[model samples]
Target: MSSPTSVLLAGGGSAGHVSPLLALADTLTRRHPDLVVTALGTEEGLEARLIPARGFGLRFVPKVPLPRRPSADLLKLPGRLKAAVDAAGAAIDETGAEVVVGFGGYVSTPAYLAARRRRVPIVIHEQNARPGLANRVGARFTTFVATTFSTTDLPHARRIGMPLRREIATLDRSALRDEALAHFGLATEWPTVLVTGGSLGAKRLNDAFASTVAALSRGGVQVLHVTGQGKTFVPDVPAVGAPYVVVEYADRMELAYAAADLVVARSGANTVCELTTVGLPAVYVPLPIGNGEQRLNAADVVAAGGGLLVDDDALTPHWVETELIPLATDGDRLAVMARASAALGEPAADEQLADLVELAWGTRA
Candidate 1:
């Protein structure tokens, strides 16, 4: 057997899945210029735009959400899954896909099934500390399974770490410090905290940071707050000494990462990986909902003394004044955390994952 000439990469609905999918796609294509890579996702997913924008062909599959409880959607699941699998199989057939790589989301289940039916090799990548249902199902048919977090419970799990964007994985914070400061219009004198609430912005984070902008400035700390798209945050008072830069969104996150000494944001799998990979300290405020995966995602780093992990509700304006202010201003502490974060990060994860894909294809009969 030889490496796959063509492969179908499936996953979507969120950045956690799409980011890795895109990163792996880029690596595989770069390694094999003649390789044919097509993405499978629903139009509703972020992948619909991201995949195509990245210059990969995308095939649509019906988004199938597995019900948590007995519902009318449960009754319709079989038909939806069948249709999605059929669509996925057709994509495989059309592209002459010899293997399938799935990142575990709404589109992964069908990609796994279709590849199994076609006798094509399947490689699964589980992103979170807790595996999602799609990856759990996909794992059954594949011996090649990769995970971002070591604590992730999945069959045949191999922790290759997260496949991160090239910009994030290769970011040299010190080297880009000046560029970052100039881009965000921050002073070089003050220690900066980067505050983000993911793409959509968490109201809790927005409000907390909004209320404490003056407090942070008074502590001689600069702040770069990305308030998410369409999410606005108006500061109550002007800065006392340091700059308070607020933007709706950051197109160049690498610059933002470069500018900040500490990050105050959600502990998303991608965020954890990127921050660690780039060797930046953070204050992780995990989203309060879902299966508690966000909190789990930051466990290893927090345990390693890389960052502070706090509950969503626990992350308040008061905490910013009491805890975050001191931490950001303490240069010695932030340096120690940055070293710990870098130690835990796997910068070569994209290459390692690409190896697994090749290994899986090579073993195919």
Candidate 2:
């Protein structure tokens, strides 16, 4: 009998990278129950806990991210890359993988390259508006390239939006607002703002929101703040008209979307896609750091008229008081932005990516 088909998937670093991989894994398993999927990542990454929690086996590889400028770690990159390649090869061998799918991170670079060396077909998913270094390198070896944006410059890249979870794809806030509000112990009478700082949270976002939450509350804005794991922020003690529900982290994102009138968060690719897919008008503050890729992602949404992007340096409570308060008040304007966001939604992207992955693996099989 032919051995059961297996796939080696690689992704790491942030939950943004890991969540999509898990989403795809969930989709693949639901479609083909017998197909084996193993995640290749670093032991230290967020994936180490997340991947296994989803019931998939994880194979670890040591990897250090390559910085743009030359440094001591740069000198060790060659050795680290070699080690990661060997680890990826072993994982592929152990899983009897017919092909590899890389989800664009440091972990993916060596794993996909190892698959290429072994003549195994590879597929890559570029989730960002601008491709990351790993996906850019992996694209050359990829049998097919899948991207969230149609404008990706990767050779032979196809327009398949980010693979979102079923809940996100089919979410409708109309009927569930009451239930979502009740879950957060909030009243449904007031305007709501959902503030999330990604899975790990953003300090800048937390600080800004903490400072402004009271003012928003006084303006009759109810808040659901996902503050990440370790951070704590105390809102004003006086019951200022509206409720402020704060959570360290939330697993039920769909519910959060349903309960929100507007979103105030960082513009990570996952957040961008979720906001677009759910048709949520948002004030996006991209993490102001290296490469400015997050800003680029936010620019696409702002340029598309779906949301507004704020520079981190300029994100003050006064600005929020002026801009976001007014924007939130104008329901008509919010609806216009919502329509623009809905226009960008791609609900069928998961199936499209599945088809691409199957085709890539089928040829090798």
Report, for all candidates in order, the number of backbone clashes.
0, 0
What TM-score does structure 1 among the candidates reach? 0.97
Can you write out model 1's per-residue Cα lDDT over 1-365, one digit (the tens) per residue?
34568988998999999999999999999999889999999999899889999899999999888898999999999999999999999999999988899999899999999999989999999999999898999999989999999999988999999998898888888999999999989999999999999889889889888888889888888899999999876655453588888899999999999999999989999999999999998999999998899999999999999999888888889999999999999999999999999998988999999999998888777
**lDDT for model 2:** 0.84
Question: How accurate locally is residue 324 in candidate 2, as Cα lDDT from 0 to 100?
Answer: 77
Per residue, candidate 2 scores C-alpha lDDT tens digits across 110-218 of 9878998898889899888789888899888765999887666787899888888899988998778888999888897888889888767888778877888778787
TM-score of 2: 0.94
Q: Could you report the Cα RMSD, in angstroms, for every candidate shown?
A: 1.3, 2.1
Cα-based lDDT for every prediction: 0.92, 0.84
Candidate 1: pairs in clash: none
Deviation from native of the Cα of residue 157 in model 1, angstroms: 0.9
Predicted candidate 2, C-alpha RMSD: 2.1
Candidate 1 C-alpha RMSD relative to the actual structure: 1.3
Off by over 4 Å in 2: 1-4, 237-240
Q: Tell me the deviation in Å of residue 64 in model 2.
A: 3.7
